[model samples]
Target: MKLVLEGIGHAFLGRAVFEKLDFSLAPGEVVALLGPSGCGKTTLLQIAAGLIDPLRGRIRRSYRRHAVVFQESRLLPWVTTRDNISYGLRVTGGKSTSHRQIAERRAREVGLHPNDLDKYPVELSGGMRQRAAVARALAVDPDVIFFDEPFTAVDVGLKRVLQDLVIAAAAREHFSALFVTHDLSEAVRVADRLVVLSEGGTGFVTNRRIDGRPGDRSDRAIFDMMEAWSRDPAFSELFDGERKGLP
Candidate 1:
């Protein structure tokens, strides 16, 4: 299965952010979408999620189910982390092998302890909150998972952990991903393919067939890719070593 983006285009509030944005994700492929701020990265992700309508172009996919992890945890403030993780499963009536008690099992796979199941969002750190969000999305057993900067506020160590978790899941579950992030380092560590978002969110291939090196995120090749893209007149001014938001 693959998600094909043919000439995908969009504008925000009368301002064009991108045009003719084309890309695709084959089954089990984790593709990272990287671009500078104001390039419409988030807008592209949202369009993929059906949260926003594209002003033009066509998106074709045959996936039966999908899920997303927004940059912010976006959890229900009132629920415990465990409840939050299992909430989507309950809502969708999801069932795996044992159908009856899969929610608890799913949370355990993502490293959430049974005890912390009762802790609410107010009690967890930013990283832990995002972890719960990840577990929730995975529990849905989606064919496509959209991760919109899942590691932003997370510390480096935890970012590695989360990246590994995502990679392992893709390997085991054969799920495809459209991961959006501004961190070039992250794109190298987790993606099988990379699409750089140029000015106004237009995407152009930067790196493909990455075959992620979970440990060598800082490799020279990764930096070289960033340097080459940054030197290109189209994207040179985008990064500028500046931080960008999920939007």
Candidate 2:
């Protein structure tokens, strides 16, 4: 396994978020974590990424490098897109001259135009900012990446494009990922396996392997799988409010 969480539990301000959660990720695998709002999916991803220490658990990570793409772009507004993309390299101590070269290469890989590289985050579109965010995470050449609902704010078309970018990048780079999202269709499109958290963040509801490879499934197939899972008893909590017409 590339990462493992054993008996993990965490709380904030004396309010428990989760308890005794055991999860693991294999090399080059993408796992989508699903749950209702406030179920601690992001918290768990943060724990796995070592952003926060669990109050009770043991986390074992075999990979040497990792990066996270947050729900918001979270880029530094003061910096140009080129500098933002290469920020990881700077943190890791890369030479100044090489930062620009590496940042441009990563920007190109994520479909950012060269003209956009010199612009600050305030000057870019939401999609362009997200592209730069993804590029920033990739610039470090991480072995593992943590995604916290990274596409939820984008339009549907742009969301799919970003999803494809992630799938292609993961395939080409062989990086494992833990993607946190509430969207089932997005999960089917991106993950090799889907793991759901139980209501109230008590524990896992299910951890099931997806039928096909991330990029191999057709749109119809992905939709069908999502439709079927929406009716599954194990996934009821996730879709119950929608079915009941509750906000």
Candidate 3:
């Protein structure tokens, strides 16, 4: 499966967010979309997911199935954790033991305990809710999954665990991803390629292919790589005060 965005342009209230931007996501590849806060990363994800149409671009998608995990968990309060995780299946008209089994397996993979599946979203912690959201997305067996800083609300330890879970899932399922994040460390750890947006969200600053397996890299190794890239002359603008620099 593949996704392509050609000559994409968007604006809000006469303020141009981005214009004439071209991007693509190849099959089985994970691309991290990095930018400063409010730089239209979320907007880009929305457009790519077909939730909104770009005023000046055409989007082409070859994937038969796609799913998105927003910043918020957005689980239903009235449903059990397992039910919330299976929401995608229900929406797509998949009602069977097979779908239920997939939901249960995905929930477990995301670190939700077996006992926790019967509880409501309000009954789970913030991280648990986020895990359920991810499980729900994975349950749909999408060929591409878009994530919009879904780990920002979790604590550091849980954040890393969730990142590892996503990496493992992506590898096992061979699905592609467009991960929108401001955290350079997180981006480095999860992406096969990294692309940074300009400060005004008008264009791309850089597109770098990372070597080695991001999912297998140690945190210290990823941090060192991030540090080196931040100091590189080509990426200097990405670390300037106009944008959220690497940590």
Predictions: Cα RMSD each: 3.4, 1.4, 2.2
TM-score per candidate: 0.86, 0.96, 0.94
What clash count goes with each model? 2, 0, 0
Best by TM-score: 2
Q: What does candidate 1's lDDT look like per residue over 1-247, in tens digits?
A: 4788889888878888888888788888888888777678888899988889899999898888889998899989898776777777665654543432455676677777777678898888887788788888887789999999999888889888888888778778888999998787787778887777776454673545664444445667777866776666645545663634324
For model 2, residues 172-245, the per-residue Cα lDDT tens digits are: 99999999998899999999999999877679999999998999999999989988988898799889744554
The TM-score that candidate 3 achieves is 0.94
Q: Lowest summed-lDDT stretch of 10 residues in model 2?
A: 238-247
Highest lDDT against the true fold, candidate: 2
Model 1: clashing residue pairs? 17-200, 39-201
Sorted by TM-score (best first), the order is: 2, 3, 1
lDDT of each: 0.78, 0.93, 0.88
Runs in model 1 deviating more than 4 A are 94-100, 205-207, 211-235, 241-247
Question: How close to the true structure is residue 134 of candidate 3, measured as C-alpha lDDT?
Answer: 95
